[model samples]
Target: MTDLPLHELAIERHIAAPVSHVYKIWMERLPEWWAPKPWTTEVVEMDARPGGRSAMNMVSPDGEVSPVEGVFLEIAPEQRIVFTDAFRAGWIPHPPFMTGIFAFAPDGEGTAYRAAARHWDEATMQSHSEMGFEAGWGAVADQFKALCEETWVAR
Candidate 1:
């Protein structure tokens, strides 16, 4: 097998919520926690299946919209999701950026969550790191955990 993390950026967290619950919220309410505070996400489409399209707009506080379009490579419910910006829907090729891998596993009464972005090269990986990958992705993960825990309590 090839080394997957050679050009990867990742973040992990143990969320205080069940894997099922975390996955459910992640799938159904992505925009709620996708972007960090003051930045927002608007989902254009999210079809959670292999080859399905996943499009969204990340809106800045000043209303600048950064459109993101990708296709899902794999989706294992309550387990993992892998997607790539290399291809839009219908297998149409696009300029490649990175492939996103997110995994969810049961950890006692909580969930072990991991999110990774695999880049095509070291330059792109470095670029992503320079773009505040840690702070930004960490904030998103924290948001996700908080939402899951809060929602789990409200359930």
Candidate 2:
């Protein structure tokens, strides 16, 4: 096995909701919690199966749109999801950026949700850290909590 990057950015939150519920929202209600206030998410193409396509656009308050296109490397419903920006649908090569893992596990009666971003090198990792990984992810987590807490099991 090859060595991984020396830098990583991760954030975990104990969401006051079941893992199943959290996963449901993650898949279906992503646009609801995927972005913080003043920004919104729009899924252009998403298929959660392995090797499936996942693409989304983040619209900023100033009307700027940024798209993230990737392939689903792995998905275990209510457990975890891994996706990489290195490849698009059909396994086509794209500019490698980050491989992210979103994991959800049972935490008491709630869910222990973690988001991990792996970089290919130290430079990339440092770039992400300097790009407000903590604040951005923190805002996203809070938004997720609000969405799940409000919707509960209404899916």
Candidate 3:
């Protein structure tokens, strides 16, 4: 079994868009500019309700596909979202299990978005951190913010 430790990684950024618009971009149109490294997600199923399933197939650059399935623990439109990786669609708990929380708040003329990912344990956190979690997520967040801003302007 993979080691499970308690750990947290929080990233916050100010997106130049209204909270509602930013949230829509995140949940409704994420596939657009989600990542530039050739990763795509086909949301197999999404209920967006507590105890409901949210599953997606992530296609890698090399044409390999992997499924990332989880459950939505909480969701507040334009405000917050929480999900857990404790149970996948068809698999049991695996290594580095995590719970992710995303929060959005009004910041001046924009939205302050924060994402906190809590892993099962310190070892798992260390492993993910070493695997470039900061850089990878940072890049995605940057891209997301840019897209949101562009969309906001076009609106």
Task: Give the Cα error of residue 20 in candidate 2, in Å.
Answer: 0.6
lDDT scores of the candidates, listed in order: 0.95, 0.90, 0.81
| Each candidate's clash count | 0, 0, 4
**Any runs in candidate 1 off by more than 4 Å, and if so which?**
3-5
Top TM-score hit: 1
TM-score of each: 0.97, 0.94, 0.87
- Candidate 3 per-residue lDDT, tens place, 72-104, comes to 889999999998888764445544368889899
RMSD of 3: 4.1
Name model 3 segments beyond 4 Å from true: 1-6, 89-96
Model 3, position 101, has a per-residue lDDT of 90
- Candidate 3: count the clashes: 4
Using TM-score as the measure, name the better of candidate 1 and candidate 2. Answer: 1
Ranking 1 against 3 by lDDT, winner: 1
Over the stretch 8-83, how does candidate 1's per-residue lDDT look in tens digits? 9999999999999999999999999999888999999999999999999999999999999999999999999999
